[model samples]
Target: MGAHNGVNNMHEVAPMEVSVEAGNFQDAERLDDDGRPRRTGTFWTASAHIITAVIGSGVLSLAWAIAQLGWVAGPAAMLLFAFVTYYTATLLAECYRTGDPETGKRNYTYMDAVRSNLGGAKVVFCGVIQYANLVGVAIGYTIASSISMRAIRRADCFHTNGHADPCKSSSTPYMILFGVVQILFSQIPDFDQIWWLSIVAAVMSFTYSSIGLSLGIAQTISNGGFKGSLTGISIGADVTSTQKIWHSLQAFGDIAFAYSFSNILIEIQDTIKAPPPSEAKVMQKATRLSVATTTIFYMLCGCMGYAAFGDEAPDNLLTGFGFYEPFWLLDIANVAIVVHLVGAYQVFCQPIFAFVERRAVAAWPDSAFISRELRVGPFALSVFRLTWRSAFVCVTTVVAMLLPFFGNVVGFLGAVSFWPLTVYFPVEMYIKQRRVPRGSTKWICLQTLSITCLLVSIAAAAGSIADVIDALKVYRPFSG
Candidate 1:
């Protein structure tokens, strides 16, 4: 396979040289092996991208998920999910190039990797799952950013009007504001162009996560010792047995969502520069570092939050009013969350934009609407791109306003996308690419792993649906 890919890449060499000759001296050096603008992405930039995508608003729900699953199961589920994600990410990274790690045709997206290794109807299936997941993430981030925005206002209200005050404010306007911000940021032309944004977002992720962890620890100390049981929230008058089962299952979805950047792993890999060291190896290292770093934060935040609030932990520890005093600090943390989501929203949505634009260009070929661009000072703006991306943000924002059940929505998305995008596809692609042989020990183990996750995803999705139904019984998201 590697030799075949090497031969194929050899064909591109002549065209690349011809194109360079047609252009300037600088163009040759600025081009990659594939004739695209040179990818300046390095280990640090790749790690930043992973960190920005991995540690998102989803982290805020870890404590709540932990609360449902209890001490033993909560931490265990997080670790298990992290390991599974990292393992599958490594597999997907190996699929980044069809033949040779360096010379093979690059798979620019998750769907491309699927088409290369497990071609057929599966490529279409992968596209549906991957893009749907990205859209859901865009919606989820919109909802999360609004939550933080309202938290800031609510915190100020409480501080000014006294704790007894209702301190209410609707999230609809905030969601709209966030949507507007995203519309502006969505115009960035390429993933590599946003490396600085990713770096800043990564820093903000750590900032808010550290703040949440710190607040949980302080609250735990004040309460004196840990407050949760080995079994987690107990079944009682407030919590029926049926609800307990649903919550526990939904916890699985939350944790799964927290570790899921696999859908974008290939897209991230595409930004990496040509390598003496393969892009797959660099991506593997980034995955390991990101998973380990996030896992530690998850443990501390989840455990401490459960300890602080016991059975009553808020769905979002920071925004759920778990810490009322030090209103200024809460304000800063919430601001950081808002800033982080601003970057995260783009991190998830860029692929969708690229996909649509690519398809339009291929289909239209020379149509002015698809091919023309207007100069805006320093940046060249595409008419179709600006309209399409803006409309996309608006649609997701409207949907987010209608269904802003942050925790449940994320759980549902995680459940729906986890097995297909994160596990099954990667596992299948790996088997086919490596020709692992049917019914062999290794192949059986991989299939078993995939099947187990599928069952888990089914249950988690069912649980999330139940939770959503229950939430709608009193759903008044636009109201404070």
Candidate 2:
């Protein structure tokens, strides 16, 4: 199947062709003439990628969101979001299952899928949005990482000088450190090394949640016991119905905890080496596992965090609960989370690089022209021929550092990019390609559900964008 450009005589080839042109880089180091990764399929490889994608800066934010929404609605919303996630994930898996194997034509990257389902312009639009979103996530993760480190230092009395806050030490030093670590870790030539870091991150995450939850629960119980004394110490009151609604709606960001795993589906597809049919099954299973794991973790963390803070929990729940007595454990957890955030950055970076590489090859089909344009030494030209790859990394780092207060932006972009890629576009492909029985009950029900999901996703995108704007307007200093 091919697409015809509006220009009378010109025809843009099928979007699937780009996948063939882009070439799978999963095993570039061990690439055979077949243009496929050399590795055999394994369950662990798929599982690790999914796990890394699911856990990120979102972990801290989930509980705060739950606090905003009523406790009753929080888990319900997450469950609903999980269902939506599963449906969308299954649709994409179906697309992959039916995709052409020889040309790598079955599974399309986010943009390719969008272009095929919608049109070329949308592909470009979504690509730009996705790239920006990934950059925001990377920077946001870095900022959060730095803030977590600073918190640990202050808790341990490392800031000997009379500074009120550890983070205030010097942005320059932290920025330099963050940049060096990002470059070194990101340049690891194989997934094996990356997986090792992920394992460390997972262990740290478990420890962090366990410690933070225990301390938070203890504090909450203590505060509750002394409720009589704090009777009139109201921080704020719930007055209007609208206020309650807004609060509840805000909590829906907790559901986004699962949305963070959307990229994992793509990552698993890219990393695992299997025939198209097996790859599709693997992607489906991986997506389910990732979301399930994230959901359970968020629910546990949210409940504990809410109990700890009670009505007084700070907006950022995790930070509000100071590190507990096991100072060394807190330090380890903090460091581990920072490392996990780095892995999250890589998750965000891969697609950005892939998209840029495709555009680069398309723009300059001639190797010599591409080489001259990239302007690298001939020896390095083959490996670094894509301008957008480096451009994305530099631009992402600069923007992330400058927009240090980008939590809402990160969440918003995560939702916005996720909606079309995860929900609308995939459904569109399924309808057009599969053409489920037109008048049958199942077909009608499916269409109705798809339409509803599309509307909900649009609302989510709009709300998230507004939230980002509000956050930017009220940027504050790192008081901790």
Candidate 3:
């Protein structure tokens, strides 16, 4: 709805006017130069953004996760988490339309909802975790993209111990190159401006997932049975008790992380063009449709890839397969993943960019650099904007280079932020914003689920951190 500032009395503000208000010349002048559009996309485009945000490198690891949990538990966990996240998404959708179901205001961002319901220190806490998760995930995208590229280029030149041989490609240079390309793409001025990117990214996700599943089917047919059928699939069947416990927890974390999208839900909803009454409904539809589509892909990819490779599957599906002559299909799939992650990194980072820009403006009311745009190559660039964003991309790229274990970093990020961003914040904010009765069943069940997720996330986060630490002990820092 309206801003918390009370400058505007109406519930709905035009998308262009977001963060820009009457009497705020800085916000207004910045928009005038940027040509940012408002309320431009329909339901499908909004769903595309949701899909782009939801499906990332996580899908590639699902089969390995299924291997950890076995056939019966793996698909079960995916469906269960999908349903839970979809429900939480709907709750978050309701929070976006806060004041009136018909014409009252709505929250334009996830932080907006947090500020409205759980203000004070919670807002600051939310902002910290939110930006950390965004930046961390962007780093993860860098790591994954670079790894995928390196895998494609050097799959045949690796050592027996998994290190790249001398003369083989390293992830560092590829990461820097990817970051350079992403810095260019990240210059899009508005969230709505990148709808086309999201659409393309979504299509790429479908393409890669389909390819993975098809390759699995082909491999099974060629081999005439499952890859590890003799050894069994479940962790508990052959592994020690301690191994099973850790592996199962990691699997749970991976699946839960795969379903995470709450951090960007409100921002994606802000892209939808509709009347107040229809806005919430449209967002709900988009969320449901995106989740449903991703769920189907996850099932196909996870089950089929597991059937093909079983426990031998690498954390990254693409990396699991050894190099084949004329491996153009695998190369194409990796290219698609890299392209999709380029868009995804921007989608998550845009919020952090907006936050930093707004803070700079508010903290320094008289700074002239905020609105000054100069020509850089073909794009108009602001010194303040370019400086911070480039720094952001650089920070993530350096981190990716430092810790290039793509799956481990992703799990750590998900474990740390999934509870607050995906589960807890939405449920708590909904109950508080809507004033759901303390004793009501809806309140009780939602709160219970949120708490359970928090506890589980804590354990998962600890385990993931241990894995990262163990990885650090052996990994040569900055090694090429």
Q: Rate the local accuracy (lDDT) of all candidates.
A: 0.85, 0.56, 0.75
Q: How many clashes (backbone atoms < 3 Å, residues ≥3 apart in a chain or on different chains) does model 2 have? A: 2
TM-score of each: 0.92, 0.74, 0.86
Scored by lDDT, the top model is 1
Backbone clash total, candidate 1:
0
Q: Which candidate tops TM-score? A: 1
Model 1: residue 179 alpha-carbon error in angstroms = 1.4
Please write out the lDDT profile of model 2 over residues 130-149, one tens digit for every residue. Answer: 66667667777767776666
Q: Of 1 and 2, which scores higher on lDDT?
A: 1
Cα-lDDT of candidate 1 = 0.85
Ranking by lDDT: 1, 3, 2
Rank candidates by TM-score, best first: 1, 3, 2
Candidate 3 structure quality by residue, lDDT tens digits, 292-370: 9999989988887888777777788886553242367887888888888887777778778878888898998788788
